[model samples]
Target: MSRISVLVVDDSATMRSLIAATLRRDTDIEVVGFANDPLEARDAIKRLNPDVVTLDVEMPNMDGLTFLEKIMRLRPTPVVMVSTLTQAGAEVTLAALEIGAVDCVGKPGAGVTAAEAFGDLAMKVKAAARARVRPLGSAPVVEKREGYSGGDKIVAIGSSTGGVEALLTVISAFPENCPPTVITQHMPATFTKSFAQRLDRASAAHVTEAVEGAPLETGRVYLAPGGHTHLEITSGAHPRCRLVPADPVNGHRPSVDVMFNSAAKHGPRVVAALLTGMGRDGAQGLLALKEKGARTIGQDEASCVVYGMPRAAFELGAVEKQLPLGRIGPAILDLCSAAAPGRDQ
Candidate 1:
């Protein structure tokens, strides 16, 4: 296969160099050019037509977000955002993802080594190179859905890579009093809090980062925190969130498999959906849920940015229905509605 060519764009010379050098360590990636600002980056893009671009969240002349919006509107090229690990940076990075960036990596912080920060940069670059990027216009106004009764069922969702945008769409369509929902979106440790805040603003359901012993209640959505804890559910009359400090499962803390498997033990009154991501972390766990008679849904390939996790689940016979991104949210709600006829339990 041809090497994945990349253009490094950052305002700081040190960041550009560090990013280029780190990507060079991977034989599969080639740093085609560097740019100190969006102007130079635009020139480089026209000149090199690199397979992918690594963009900084902040830049001079024009801000990265404005430039990114322009690129998605015109060129529609896959981009991976490089950002700092902070609340401010997280908000900007999430905006970039919604603007069509494929993934993100954080710059080294105080006491954090460059090696640790850039460890996953090359992998993300490769994923971006293969990502299906399309022009993203203004987000469609999702008219809030109604008539959703908080039945006995609960909802579980897992996503990564393109999940920020996907989750925004899904959650926005939810009614004010939706089912008790649990989500595991693979992200850096510091980013989940900001993302939860973003979700809460967009969603009628109360969204929060999972804390220990939070009961699964109607009108609430618990997002698994991103750090060293895995979010699990304790099965019983009152299911509650449990944060486990165990080692990473499937190379991810707060693994989707851990969450899905835990939900499976809660019996058949579960509704689960796996969205776009770049690994098989949730496939087996979705299969376990299917075996226990839980309703399962997967985002179809045409609607996925990477189509990795959802594809794995579909192939494993875990997905009872595969639908486009616009439809999965309503489908999950329909399955969990009190008016829906009885299924195996």
Candidate 2:
């Protein structure tokens, strides 16, 4: 097979060189070109036609966001954002994801080293290379869920890889009074806080990073904090968010399986969905939910950037329904209506 070609775009010479070296460590990836600014990137993109582009979120002459817009508009391709590990940089990086960049890794900054910077870059670039690119204007419109009833059910969603884009579409469609939702997305500490904030801004429902003992409430969403803790549900008058410190499960802290397995103890009151991700982290836990008569859904392969997780769940007979990415939000809403508090028939 041919090598996975990459174009490294960053204003800092050191950053570009460092990124190139990191990607080169993987035998399958080759550095096709380097661009110091968007203008150079524009020219190099046409010349090199690389499989992936590692783009700096900030640069002189046409910022990365505007340049990313043009890339999505004129030429849709897999792009990964290399953003600074700052609040402003986090905002820009989240916008990049919304604009169709496959994924992002924080640039080396205070509290982040070059070694930590490359932690996910090469793997993300490889995944992005095989990712499907959709034109900027051709995305599915998010239709907010209407006529929602009060639901007693708890919703747990697990995703990675194509998740930032997929979750934007799904969560934004939820009503302001949607069921209590818990999400466990594979992300590093630098990204999750910004991601949760982005979700809060985008969705009508209240969204927050999970705290140690936050009470689960309807109309609110809790995103698991990235790093060392897993999000779990504790039984009570109403389910509450239980953040527990633990080793990585299925190679991820705050793993979907831990959340789902804990929710499984609640029996039929939980509704679980496994979104697009790189591996089989959530499959078994989703099956556990299904076994307890909870409604389980999986994103279909065609709509997934990496079909690994959802495919694993489907093969395991964990998913009661397999729907395209565009349909999952409405499907979840339907499930909520069926099981709403006092409305369950």
Mind giving the per-residue lDDT tens digits that candidate 2 earns over 49-100? 9999999988999899999999999999899999887778877888898888
Cα lDDT, model 2, residue 333: 80
TM-scores vs. true structure, each candidate: 0.97, 0.94
Candidate topping lDDT: 1
lDDT of each: 0.90, 0.88
lDDT of 1 by residue, 109-219 (tens): 898899999998998888888788978784533444457776888999999988998899899878778989999999998899999999999888899999999999999
Which 10-residue window of candidate 1 scores lowest in summed lDDT?
138-147
Worst 10 residues of 2 by lDDT: 336-345
RMSD of 1: 1.8
Number of backbone-clashing residue pairs for each candidate, in the order shown: 0, 0
Candidate 1 clash total? 0
Native-referenced Cα lDDT, model 2: 0.88
> Candidate 1: lDDT of 294?
89
